[model samples]
Target: MRGNRGAHRGSPDSGSVTDVVVVGGGQAGLAVGYHLRRQGLDFVILDAEAGPGGAWQHMWASLRLFSPADHSSLPGRLMPIQSGHTYPDAAHVVDYLADYEKRYDLPVQHGTRAEAVHRDGDRLLVEADSGAWRAKAVISAAGTWSRPFVPALPGRGVFAGRQLHTVNYRRPADFAGQRVIVVGGGNSGAQIAADLALDGDVDVTWTTQRPPRFLADDIDGRALFDAATARRRALDAGRDDTGGVASLGDIVAVPPVREARDSGRLKASPMFERLDRDGVRWADGTRASADAVIWCTGFRPALTHLAPLGLRGRRGHITTVGTRAADEPRLHLLGYGDWTGPASATLIGVGRPARDAAREIADLLDA
Candidate 1:
């Protein structure tokens, strides 16, 4: 993964009994941090990265928010208005986050990567690379991208060329004048291939196991909203319904990759069966040549250190909508499950739950 600790003030070391310790410094983590600050609670944000912007700063340089600025700003801050009413790029987001941290004088402990969080008697013990902390509670804002999920295809290491995940992607020039096979048709693969094609240097080919069902607008909004509401109601009534969050295809608008495909820029191919010195082999016996393969496959929750928290359901994701483990009350999860209303993993959606979580944490500290 690509990260930058650039231009920081100091190292993150523990010195006090922080009321609550946040385990990440991304948009979600910062949201909870800001709220806890307003509550005048003794807290600190622990980020594995050395700087801000979380994963956004590490995205390909050409990346921009799919949602408009009006739909993506964090709490108490406005996204910078630009001409032409276009979406902001990666750098723009990084700058906005930096400004947010500075404006609020958010007491963030940067460069302190959380190692483990466990209960110690009546308090929580937060261990990090730099130091350890004692807190009354912990906000698990480590995000869905905490761990990059690289699938095990036969002969991955046998391929004799550069291989990179979207998380490691930086700029198009790195692969300039090369034939690239980008795996996965998610937003990242589509956008990255589009940007590379636009750069007029890299020839891009994309692959996906199955084409996602795309929407032009929020056409599927009603059905997806109904599903989320149903799940939320069941949870609120103290029932555990594992299918709270709608699938990605259900919520996100179709990525702009179709435009590239129509223009004959990005060639869509079947999923990879195996990799070799020449290129990728498909299930249909088709072979393609490439110099690099970008795996935009996706990520999983990095809860290795948190295995003791007892996450239920499949993939270790919290099964209950908007509810922490009844057994692990000290573990408050942000961006874990889908909420029926304005509370989802999206930046716009994360606010209400973040507030609710911050208050819950505050109460735990008060006790």
Candidate 2:
């Protein structure tokens, strides 16, 4: 049941009290926690993960970061330069995140998944399967990895071949020597297609609704974040925004992907019109048999835990001023993407918005 109507802090009877309750324990959540601690706020990070690393642990084995370790990091700690890795792999990121938790000694409630957030006066109550948390502010940093998106293409159900989303994909050797269709336009699609292409045994048909956007070889997460930051600054200064990541493209041409693309082994095909019992069909009725389809379509914000608040607008987007929900100022959203802040989803990019959100929350709590 709802607790109160105005912006007065609530003294809920059943939950642990804190100044802030961060609803995720991933990169974004960690960033927010770091800033909140700096502000000296009493807070706890509710992480659904049993361990650390957030969603990085679930990525494909060969997945690499878009930037080098130095450029890809959260707020305080610089990710140690991995001895031999040019671009840190998923494992390395996991290690860094785990260490980050220990380094700061951030109070994180691991294995706790937030169930919902309801307003009780000005305070927010975060309901979790493990327990309940009552705080003056709630920062929802739940990232998108849990909610993989696969398009509902025509005849998808009839396709006899194996179909899986990115969550289900781990490595390419699993689909060895089979015809596989990888669908998506962004990095995941490109990377997975390249992964399959490198296998040599797999016949990979990479399809995207639009042509894949490939950033230049030199471009990495650092450049993208910097450009995005500049763009954000320009926009905030009331200047006309121009070239940034959009002009570059979505997919980063990491070495492996470059190898696959340059050699033509990872050539992208136009999206298939529909799935057939045994394969895919094109608009011209052209058909090709496929043994499997891997959808790298991407994901939506993992905000189901915040559903009780009734803050989402059309298409589940929560309108916000920075990270604060427009309709519910006590609730802030971080790291979902551009909607929260420029490049907020990336490790390097999450800092600014996290800092901003923490500062605002601190100010509100002080008031």
Q: Which structure among the candidates has the greatest TM-score?
A: 2
Off-target runs (Cα >4 Å) in candidate 2 are 1-14
**How well is each residue in 16-45 modelled by candidate 1, as lDDT tens digits?**
465677887887788777787777676778
Instruction: Please count the clashing residue pairs in each candidate, in the order shown.
Output: 0, 1
- TM-score of each prediction: 0.83, 0.95
At residue 122, give the lDDT of candidate 2.
Answer: 63
Q: lDDT at 149 for candidate 2?
A: 82
In candidate 1, the residue pairs with backbone N, CA or C atoms under 3 Å apart (3 or more residues apart, or in different chains) clash, namely none
How well is each residue in 1-367 modelled by candidate 2, as lDDT tens digits? 2212112223333667777888889899898888887887878788899999899989899999999998998988999998888899999999999999888887777888888888888688888887777788899998998898887899999999999998888998899879999999889899999999998989999999988889888988888998888888888889998666897798999999999999989888899999989999999999889999998888999989888888788888999988899988788999999889999999999999999998998788767
